[model samples]
Target: MVIHGREPDWSYVARSVVKVLTVTAALLLTLTVGERALEVFVDVGDRTAQVYGTAARIANPDKRLSHGYTHSGRLPVTTFTMRGEPRRAGPSDGTTEYKIVEGLFGTVQAPLLDGPSGSLADAIDSVEAKPGDGRARATLDGLPPTLVGVGVVEFAHKMTTEQLVAFGRRHKICGGDDVAYIYEPSFYDDSSDPSSLNAIVWNRDMTREDDWAEFAYQCETEPERALAEFRRWVGLLDENDDLEEFELAYGSLKGAADEGVTYGLVFDRWKLADLRKLLDDPDVGTIHLADVAFDLDTWTG
Candidate 1:
């Protein structure tokens, strides 16, 4: 799932864009204005690579990002006598009543290749959606992409910045919600149409804003060490949700230090051997894996 930026509250997904939280008077030290690039160059004995990122703009510190979007589609009218997890996500009057609404913006992109892969919707409903994680991409009818739809998985799933940016390039307009670590796949919509999408623009600019920090640096370390560092980082922010958004969503919290590999485009065709092309193609971006063996551990940059 891609991170759609909020004006002041930029918190989206981890490895996606970051929400610039409110730096209370007591936590001003973490806030700074400087001209240094947030670059990372991982150069262990066996691997070497460069990472480049512009400084995250801390604009409108006093104002939070707006959640303004045109409402589209109809809230699912099919009511159900809620039970299990669905009950908790529904109206909480201690009654077992709930509605299965379309995505925050609306229903799944009309027509379907695989149909509405209810994982994102289910997560929003606080139900545990399984193996059907990742994204569900669809375009209006059989068209080229005046509108595109995607489904982002929850904590027990995987969402990558590369995948998000790939869709952003296909459509000029896009938006997403990162509630409960479950991101509803986003789509592009018209600005003039009040019924069209317009919460956050999902373009390379915003993608850069989300991924710059996460992709900029990574080093070799034991899994336990990396987990400790991540927990500490979350503790420093005192935002446990941030940890969920970043680490838990991808199972990276107790995982090892990442190699920070991301491909320039999104595709399942890539294999571990494909990384050899990185040095051949300067456009390819990544931090070396060294002796750190991995399967198809890559991201679409």
Candidate 2:
């Protein structure tokens, strides 16, 4: 097409061609920008949501201990609960501090257990011994001025929340001389049925010595608070469509208000004598030790 009646002006033709090229470039640039925006906001957002759903499950494969997840900007951070366990494996020199981060992830990446520090395998060692008075007496000699250990006390059968709390009171599982603070209780129903054993731990938030002491006190005086917390977890699980998790949580919560729920108690922190008492109890079916750490400040810090 000719812009003017005169024979096509070369300079005019050149200007028209340049304008068409500029328009095409602009349209392409806009489409590219739109596609990138969609990828970042929509696609990344959906993947992050999926990460949130799987984070807790992946972090806590069996639930003998407590696990939780929270977001840090775009990153998902998962925490495994331990009372005074070292953050990473190291000598009990005063310098080591306990860390809670169990899983950290990116939108497209799987949740990773060990970060730069070390593998959890290196950190948490299984403390093995048959549960009995002999093991209890053996623990008394090695304990430090201040120490933390994870121990599991399995009962012959499932006990209601009331029974567990009463058991705590009867054993005097509180922080003080000759007594160890019960940091949190791991509650599970299908523990005997190894095929589907799932447990839930309560109150990983008690990070400080006083926090644990107070929790131990609450276990005796106001067990209802723990029951309430269990119910709250059930409610939170109800909001999601994860039927497996919901059923497990709900099953634990069932006896919280009425009788109680749990076949055993997983103790996060134990004193020399406290471990002894649990081991000596005829009602306790078995005791599983996870690991121990010396120096309380490092854990509380």
- The best candidate in terms of TM-score: 2
RMSD of each: 25.7, 12.5
Residue 109 CA error for candidate 1 (Å)?
39
Best by lDDT: 2
Q: Compose the digit string of candidate 2's lDDT tens values, residues 137-204.
A: 45545566256565555564556656666776797654222122122233234545322322333342
lDDT of each: 0.22, 0.41
Which segments of candidate 2 are over 4 A away from where they belong?
A: 1-110, 113-148, 174-198, 204-219, 239-259, 295-301
Q: What would the TM-score be for candidate 2 when compared with the true structure? A: 0.44
Compared with the true structure, what per-residue lDDT tens digits does model 1 show for residues 133-223? 2121111122222212122212222334354344233432123221111122222235532222101111122112233254321112221
How much is the lDDT of residue 19 in candidate 1?
A: 29
lDDT of 2 at 267: 54
> Runs in model 1 with CA error above 4 Å?
1-128, 131-157, 176-236, 239-301
